[model samples]
Target: MGALLFRLQQEPAWFVPLAVLGALHVAAVAFRILSHLVLLLRRPTDLCHRYGTWAVVTGPTSGMGRSVALDLARRGLNLVLVGRDPAKLQDISDTISCTYAVQTKTVVVDLALIATPQGDEALRLLRHAVAGLDVGVLVNNAGLAKPCAVYLHEADVEAWVRMISVNLWALTEVTAVVLPGMVERGRGAIVNIGSGTTLTIPSFPLFSIYAASKRYVTQLSRSLHVEYRGKGIDVQCQVPLFVETNMTLGATASRKRRSFLSRLIMPTSDEYARAAVCWIGHGPLCMPNLGHRLEWCICHVVPDWMLDELCLRLNLWHRVRFQRLRTMRASRTNVVNDGCLPCKQV
Candidate 1:
């Protein structure tokens, strides 16, 4: 301080005042940044970025993850992109780097493998990839919807386990690895991408595991926000419904149970991704479409019984299509058995 004053003492009076003011402004910014850094370094758990420089984004292979990565790349931050397929990650990183002209690197570790009892093996690989860099932003977005078409009776246990691993455990493990540095630095952000299923009550009918997984994400995000709000760390939850992606293409047998309503107001993956990045950076939560809130408002005004009946009717209508097809099939069979080709009777 004395050295600074001595140098300033030799300056013109007008120059000295201007220099002092500029120095004060720079000091204020540095202090604010330092304070945030302090809070970030206090702990080492979950997704934290209190004192780091890199943003870690998972599932950069497609859909929301790919979209989110692209948007973040444009934001001028160096990124660590994670995905299962090495080639796919490389392809994505190349496209993003070439197109956005941003610093890019890829780390391919299957989140599913990272969550298992033998997960340490894969985690070791991931740890090696991220060992040198400090990750400040954790984007918890990779998840899977259960594959069920007609009956909830049939559940694929292996797939369910993998889903659980990817949807929840992968998020936690990566967060655990990155959070220590963030807490030590006291300046990070964790953005968990959740689903609107918790509120929409969509007759998505077969995504029991998917909905359950996202509810955990939503709850975890809220709890983290409340717990770490004072720590200069921001935990945000982004819940999107019916995003236009390959998952919701309606081409799959499992997602065929989607009601007309769900398939109607679906937003594009890009829209949801853009809103997610913007909101999670600023607040604890962000809902993309105003129409979803409006629909939610109407749903609240309507009686629960009415909604229930509407859902029930939709299910019945859905089943009736199969029933009518069955009726047609049986009638055709009977006609064939009776050796009557002129006209078929039910």
Candidate 2:
């Protein structure tokens, strides 16, 4: 034993570095494998031609919601499309019907003011959507991201109310309406399209209202996942960063707009939707982008004070970027203090 110890002590110190590198490589491969495995386990491919599983998609007329509908329809699940735009909803219905050869239903009820009582328009619409079918999936993807000014969301009161209704209240209501049936059936999946901004510390630049609403979603999904875990109900939140959507384009180019570190990170909608949909059937709380994941980790691991300082700089830098946009706007569109004019239409 003494001879062995002396020999080991004399071994080259370079082995430590080599061992660390080897360990790191192993960890990376392990993580990659695990990620794909989980994804495969949750992917909708398993349910192809699985007729009679009703999947209701909120905000199905646009953005992530539309993409999710396409994914589900491709797999042959009967779909009920929900959104405020009847014309747009009808267009989607026709296309999905012609392309996928699956049954499609439509509900044009606005969630902005859905009531609790029977005959209440919103509930009535949802009830009718799944009138005779068992809902196996629900996607709460409808929301609004409005422009703002100041350190927090001091936007017009009406705008805040609208955002709150669509982003938070409507989502909660839909989940509540469908949860009982899911619990009774003992098998269901719920997907909430939340925001990555809520997971970060600095809050939403000038549009804090939007992030605040989404924060409620993450909390609700986490709580429900715990409450309904054994009942066969799966709830999840999808947080994406800088997704390329009309919403993002409008919000990023608004009069009160700004840019920051997020400008360095741009994620495409197609990839985000695919990853988020893959996560829904597996578990809850799926964040797809790498930049968002890193920011979330730093927020958790670092001291609050340090994060606070960083957040402050990020806020100001974003504001400056917005100001630059204002400066670059057409001279005729310039407003007070060199701000760009409000967008002609959202």
Candidate 3:
């Protein structure tokens, strides 16, 4: 410490300036970390009170969507559950209604059909479903992904079409359907579920379509937040890292290779949703889960080229694993068809 002080005194002009800049940088980083810590430990926002009473969730039958729906219901908000399947929607609706003393409404619509003639009908139905209701929150959680990672040209055109339709077209249409009401009421929150793959890395190689779709979501949320903040609306794009959703778990189902570290880093859908609900009506773009936030920090610190290469390799590995799982499932289906054993869906 004395030597540093002597050096600073000896070269005050350059040394002192550099030392001040370094200290300022360190302080900025420490403040950021401390703020994140506070967010992590803070009590959840009373969403029902902050926003209005009714909350709408898309793709509420599974994964983060289902979990987020349940979490919001637990917080005393009535739910409007939208999905493709009537049965699954009813199941989750019943579960929420019975479990949480909250009003539950289910609207069955295939969001993937958004650009079609049926989509117009679906949109009308969606509009009617939420019309005149004090719907204050919209969770555009419905999304689609390729069964496995593949190059754009090599991937099925139809698969890419459906993904874009659901991820982009559907989300936009649903938001349009809901936003006017919010604008009229002058209060609401829209939470769009985005993937961490788009933000943490510069390039996601094999899963280009999925990554590109989520990038659109993040950009939309930011623009909407800026546009609507004055009107008493909060638009947030909540990006999550590797959560143990059906998408990720299905890849590793046949292989018992998930170690402790993997589990530590990869939260389940329910776990991520718990943290996710706490951040609603807050940030424009955020990683809600603490583990994901840590990974986000590390990814930013890593060199861009290094992150790109690591992501490419990891996705390639995932591609291979997913293909193998599909093959196994096919084989099991054939055996079941042969009446060799009882059938179980993966």
All candidates: TM-score: 0.69, 0.74, 0.90
lDDT of 3 by residue, 215-255 (tens): 99999999999999999999999998888876674436733
Query: How badly does each model clash, as a count of residue pairs?
Result: 20, 0, 0
Name the best candidate (by TM-score).
Answer: 3
Where does the lowest 10-residue lDDT sum fall in candidate 2? 43-52
Off by over 4 Å in 3: 1-3, 9-25, 249-264, 333-344
Please report, as a residue range, the 10-residue window in candidate 1 with the lowest summed lDDT: 42-51
Would you list the C-alpha lDDT of every candidate in the order shown?
0.71, 0.72, 0.88
Query: What's the lDDT for candidate 3?
Result: 0.88
Give the number of the best model, judged by lDDT: 3
- lDDT ranking, best first: 3, 2, 1
Q: What count of clashes does model 3 give?
A: 0
Task: Quote the positional error of residue 43 for candidate 3 in Å.
Answer: 3.9
lDDT of 2 by residue, 1-346 (tens): 9998787678799876787887986676568556756665653554432212778899888777888898888767779998878899999899899999788899886787754453276677787677667788888988887544345434567667777877887888888878878878778888888878777665555667777888899999989988988887878887776676664543465423435555325544555566666666556787755555555654665676776677667667776776676566644454533555654421
* Per-residue C-alpha lDDT of model 1 across residues 1-346, encoded as one tens digit per residue: 9999798888887997787887986676566445434544444233223335578888888999998888877765568888889898898899888887667778767788875556777677767766767667888777776443335566667778888888889888887776666677677888888887666664345456777888888888889888877877788887776677876533344445656665445656676665566555556765555445445545655676776668666545655565676689888888887988655544
Q: Is candidate 1 or 3 superior in TM-score?
A: 3
